[model samples]
Target: MEPLELVPGRYIGEGQPCFVIAEIGQNHQGDMELAKTLRQAKECGADCVKLQMSSLPHKFNKQALSRPYNSEHAWGETYGDHKKHLEFSRDQLHELQEYATQHDIPLTASAMDIPSLYVLHELNVPFIKVGSGDIHNLPLLRTAAACSKPLVVSTGMSDIAWVSQVYEELTIQDPPTPLVFLQCTSAYPSPPEQTHLRVLDTYAQMFPHAHIGYSGHELGIHVTIAAVARGARVVERHLTLNRTWKGSDHSCSLEPHDLRELIKAIRSVEAALGSPLKAFQPSEEACFMKLGKTLVAARPIRAGQMLEEDDLVAKVAEPRGIPAQRLGSLVGGYLNRDVEQDESIMEADVL
Candidate 1:
């Protein structure tokens, strides 16, 4: 598939560097100052920093919003209040976007509802995110596709049938929306058993035109790095200053140090992934000279004697000779000259 230009000069797809998104989400806890600090994701090597945007009234029904939310992490007594507390004002989001620019990184947000989707469009974010909760909302999906910006959609709390339907709806347009499908499991701090990273392969197979990625809520960077190694062209992980902070996402979010390590490990893995072709590498030349084995004469034989398998052995011969693998071909061939016991076998030594 051709690369999707996510931001100016930044692409996501085959041969491009994995696009890493540090999702700040609601971990800012409604603190504007903390939000700015979280934007430092660029310093930690993220290609983009993302937040979650929602207009509570447009996003949730009254009954759902009114439900009491009294968990230890609650910022308010009701679910609505808690979400409102974390929701950044439109003006605040604009400020953060400008801040991200000064830091030289792209800033984006997941539109939790249609209203917020339009808001992000107005902000001209390089791309728009569709969090898993909105994946089943076909109207929002259509609206996001209509916006024509790159869309990064998380597939969580969803089945393949629904995901396939959504993929069709979004891509049926004339030009087809520039899209990325991220395999995700909604569980916070998702257990390894449920992570189902192989879903990345499924998405790639199911939607060859769309870029495939992984959005991880697991405890460490290992799974995230593994996702990259598994051919994920994009990866998203939540970011937090402290995992012990009073928020649900905080528990699963990567700290600054952890984010740095994750990026470092990802680049290393990408480098190691290299080309698929297998051949002798220049880096191994020294080791090959030091320890590579060759076929050697196991016993002395006079000229005109037929070579025998029993007469050949592999060893680190003083002078590199016909490779050990050629020993089989040498069998039954008459020797052109006398050879000393244990001498390396050369092509010229056989007729």
Candidate 2:
């Protein structure tokens, strides 16, 4: 979410610095072992790390659990067990908050249901994030907005109107409103053709008061970095230690190498963007010496002879001479010295 008033506000959407979120999501794979291992995700260049808050029963049907939505990395045989394994208790979340705070990383998450939202509220999380699945959950959206916490809303599968409605609803609060919309395409490793990056611009125009962002599902670093270059202020991408880790998000998540590369690229893009000034730079000052023209003697000319175009030629290696552009005014001036052929001519050598 790009709303900066939520404590870490300076890093959200446009003109403000980009806030990079490393989404750990369910890659914790229901093992607290993995979550603790990721306390340093921030050191890897993320401003925040995100988790998913969900209840096992609410998230999966009983039948689905028995059948077990089989994924290679899941710990349990069924979907319920898998979610149960992934679920972190309130105490666990509190520990996570402490770890994040201690490390100077913002720990945030997406609320998938009312109970999850209640848990987050109880935890007094810094903000609320709505995922692609909940974009149309008006009641959930209202509940989230009512909390008056900063909101990060993702638009994965919705049309413009659907997103517009969400924006309008969130704004029932006030101006300089505290919400940001992430342009997302809801697919596991979403396709490039489907990534309508142009929506970031449209969203910015439609809700100029809100921060516009990009939540990436692609399998690499290029798209997220490109989004920053195009003016997106918030970038949230799935992240994992290993892409091969089995989970819904693993296939699309950035491994440490890729995530690091993206962070470097985004920062380089910002440095390269610089201020829009068109003036010459320090490194460019050298070019002028090689390319600029300076007046030079075309051939030997006696001191009494008035200078003539044929007597001088413009050439590089200026040697502190008058520039060639001023040669016209010096045409009839007297020669102060007897100049040799092909010698660089100085203004002091003429009247």
Candidate 3:
């Protein structure tokens, strides 16, 4: 089963570089001036930038909307007010999309409701993301699958049964859409114990045709890299300009320096995961020349004398000589010439 390749020519699979997403979900806080932050993501070496798009009324009921919300991160008295303030207008989204396109960064978004999903379709985004909160919303998933764009869905607060059901729903469509499943731990600043990164393997097993990814809410960048090492083809992490910003995800988000370092380390890790076949490498040549042990004579031996194991010792020879691994075969061979003690033993010396 070949892994799915997303738009912009980014491959996510065993032999491909890990695709990275910089999630800018509501971090702009209703300030379109911060849209330029997408450039920062590209400079930090992210393959894509993601934002959250939703309609407040479409996503929340009356009771949920009117509920009081008081926290250092809250922007309004009620949850709905805060959400509406954070929602981007259609024109705003268009402007951001244009900006992202001009900069050559693939901009994607997670739609919380059917309306937002259609809006993203109208925008013609390279891909659409279904966040964890909407994983159980089969109707939305059905609609998203119908959008015909590549889909990247996150499974966080849902179980395997629910995921399987979603998979069945999506596959039932004619000419099934390409899909990528991201293993996510939904908590803000999720604890390491609850990360459950190994679920990436389970997703690969259950949906062998789809690419598997990780959406990390953990505090540092290492867990995301670890996910890459564990066969996660894509990695998504929240990004913010400043951790002190007043937003629910700010603390867990990677700031500029953190993001730069994370990307560097991720690329390094990918390079280090080289081929599985164990053999000699060009990089090992210098070390081999300096430290590779070779068979050497432990005592002087006259010509025509049969060599013995006790007469040889393995040492770092000045010039390349018979490898110590072939010492067993040399034990009964006759020396062709006299050799001094501690001298390197060459294959030509044996008969």
Candidate 4:
């Protein structure tokens, strides 16, 4: 219920590497062998790897289990039965936790129900994510918040009011930990227009106390990169071995190579965001001084002549000249000597 204390080298907000999360979400497809492929997520340079935990039997409508809901898809007939094929047992999840820790990648999960929440809480995770489907499930959110773990929630399908409601419900009791909000759209393979990266700017003001993130379903590394540029402190991207792989999320998920590209781009964006403070940038100072305008003589003028409108012009290089605006003051004053055309006019040239 308190802000999680971040270690010195690991700054999560502001100018840190946009913390990358590869949401493995059910892409494990219930095969522990396939789940083992998640080891590659860390190899792709993810800051954390996430899973979605749901006791399908407990959480889904049992009616969907009886009838085989025929579909063009290759899965089970009923929705519930289809989910059963995707479910992983407690042991498989435990092995995943161990594997992630061994690789030095923090593993977390989304808890869609109480049992799912219990499973993740028991895993001793550093954070818990609330997937877009459960954004309206305040009870689950309250439970996740009460556990006092750092939380990340996706706001893809949610509106501004709903976003505010979720934040208020979760933190009103005891200010939750470093809760991060991810702008997400529930659509699989979400389109670019739905991303609305500007919301990141809005949330920055709305939730100044927490980290703002982007949970992207878009097709490229550019949106992910732009999110970090827009001030996302965290980025959640789905990961899969191949887009052609037969899974509901495979289409939107980043393959290992794409994931590598994403990390590269986001890091570059964070490096580019730099400091909000702006003065003459170091690499630019010399160029700025050289190319910056300084006052110059507009026309030839002789000694003892009074300055006039034709006497000055703005030009680049050696800003040491009597910059153009000073032309006003230079005017009506006696010229100490002749100033040449195209030459930098100096204050000393006039009395």
Candidate 5:
């Protein structure tokens, strides 16, 4: 499959470094301090910092808005009010976009409604991020695909059929949209058991044309690292300043320190996952020198004696002679010279 370039110069594929996303979704907690968070994400080695963009009225109906938000994480009495506190105005988003451009920090956002997606598309975001909740929103998917920007879609609380529909819709575009499907579980602090990381493999097989990725809500950074090892070219993990912060996503988010370590760990694993073509590596030469075995003289033998199995033993030798694996060929051969006990059986010593 041809590698897709998600950003201008960076490519996403099997050979490319894992694209680490620091999803600062609503964790800014209506602070309007996106610049600070963006800077922190850069310091944490994030390839990109993702924000959440939404037109609340367009996304939620009156009935849904009227629902009481009673959790301790709630900033307002009702769900709508709570979301309003986190929602950024168009001007605010533009300001954040400008800041990201100035600082050279790559930034993108999740679009929850058509209007929001249009706004982001107008801004020429690196890509449009479709949150998991919108997996079945065919209209939104079509609108996003038309935007012509590559997409990073999270698939959580969704079945294979739902995913297939999304894939089919995107693939039929005039020029097929470049896509990355992030395997995710909807739980806020998704447990390891529910992560279903193996689904990444499923996505790879189902959508060979699209890049496969992971968006983890699981606790700790290990699972995120594991995702990269399992062929996820993109990894999205929530990012927050503190886990104790008053937000539903804080507990699942990685703080600056954790984000830094997660990036480090992913890169380390990428380096360690080297080429699939198996052959001798320079790094393994020392091990081969010390532990490689060769057929050796099991006991003292006089010149002109025929070599036999009883006279050979495999052992480590300074100068490698006939390898232990080829010992059968020498069994019927006659020796031309005497050999000391414990000496490697050389090819030149046999007829």
Candidate 6:
């Protein structure tokens, strides 16, 4: 698959460096000052910082919104109020976008509903996110596709057949919208057993045109880093200033130090992944000289004697001689000169 031009010059695909997203979803605690976490995300090596956008009234039914939200992480008595507290105003989102621009990092958001989607389109975000909650919303997916921006969709709380249907519908358009399918499990702090990173391979196989990625809600950086090793071209992890903060996601989100370490480890892994070809590497030359074995005389053989397999042995010699692997070619050949027992055998000594 061709690399996706996620932004003008930046891309995500095979052979490209993994694009890391710092998902700062509601960990901001609704404070504008806290939202500056975007700067921290940039400093920690995130390619993009993302927030979740939702027009509460459109995103939830009245009954769902009015439900009691009294958990310890709740900021309000009702679910609606809790969401509203975390939802930034349109103007505030614009300000945050500008702030991200000034900091030289791309800012994007997940559109939780049609209204929020339109708001994000107007904000001209580089890409739009479709969280798992909206994956089953075909109408919204169609609308998002028609908007002509890259859509990063998380496949959580849905089965493969449904994901395949969504992939077909969105990609079959006249000019297929650029798409990235992220394998995700909706559970907060998803267990390693449920992470199912192999889904990345399935997506890569099933949706060859779309870029494959992983959106992790799992604790620590290990699973997410393993996702990159598993061929994920893009990776998203929730970010927080403090995991102890009063929010449901805070418990699963990575703090600044962890985020930095994650990015650093990912880079190191990418470098180590290197090329697939097998050949003698320059880095191994010194070690080879010191420890590599070569063919040596198993017993003294006089000049003009026919050599046999039993006449040669492999040993570490002071001066490099015929490689041990060339032992077969020396068999049945006549020796040009006498050799001492265990003497290094050279190509020129054979006829």
Q: Considering every candidate listed, which one attains the maximal lDDT? A: 6
Q: Where in model 5 is the C-alpha error above 4 Å?
A: 318-320, 347-350
Give one digit per residue, the lDDT tens place, for model 2 in 19-85. 8888898888777778864565776787788888986567557787688556676678776776777
Model 5: per-residue Cα lDDT over 224-342, one tens digit each: 89999999999999998889988889999998999999999998999999988998899998998889899989999778787779989999985799888888988867778888898
Worst 10-residue lDDT window, candidate 3:
1-10
lDDT of candidate 6 over 1-351, digit per residue (tens):
677888657998778999999999999999989998789998999999999999999999999999999899998999999988999989999999999999999999999999999999998999989999999999999999988999999999999999999999998976678999999999998999999998888998899778999999989999999999999999999999889989999999999999999999999999989999988999999999998999999999989998889999999996789989998888888888999998998878888
> Compared to the true structure, candidate 3 yields what TM-score?
0.95
By TM-score, the candidates rank as: 6, 1, 3, 5, 4, 2
What global local distance difference test value does model 4 have? 0.79
* Candidate 5, position 135, lDDT: 91
Candidate 3, residue 151: lDDT: 91
lDDT of 3 by residue, 1-351 (tens): 565668667766668888989999989888888756988999999999999998888999999989998977788899888888888987898899889888889888999999999999998988899999999999999899998888999999999998988888887766677888999989999999999888988987888667899999999998998998888888899889988989999999999789999999999998988889998999999998889999998999889998889999999987778988888988888888999998998878887
lDDT tens readout by residue for model 1, 274-350 = 99999899999999888989998899988899888998899999888988888889889888899999998887887
Candidate 3 clashing pairs, residues 3+ apart or interchain: none
**Candidate 1 or 6, higher TM-score?**
6
Model 2 bad stretches (over 4 Å): 1-3, 13-15, 57-68, 71-75, 293-315, 320-351
Cα lDDT tens digits for candidate 4, 1-351: 123333223457654567888889888877888877778888888888888888876677667566676654446767777777887777778898898778777777888788988987887777888888888888888888888777888886679999998877766664454588898877888888877999988988887567788999988788888888887778889998878877768898999999998898877766777777886678997986677678777788888887777667788746378755566777677777887777777766667
TM-score computed on alpha carbons, candidate 4: 0.85
**For model 6, which pairs clash?**
none
Model 6's C-alpha root-mean-square deviation from the true structure amounts to: 1.0
lDDT of each: 0.92, 0.81, 0.88, 0.79, 0.88, 0.92
Residue 214 of model 1, lDDT score: 94
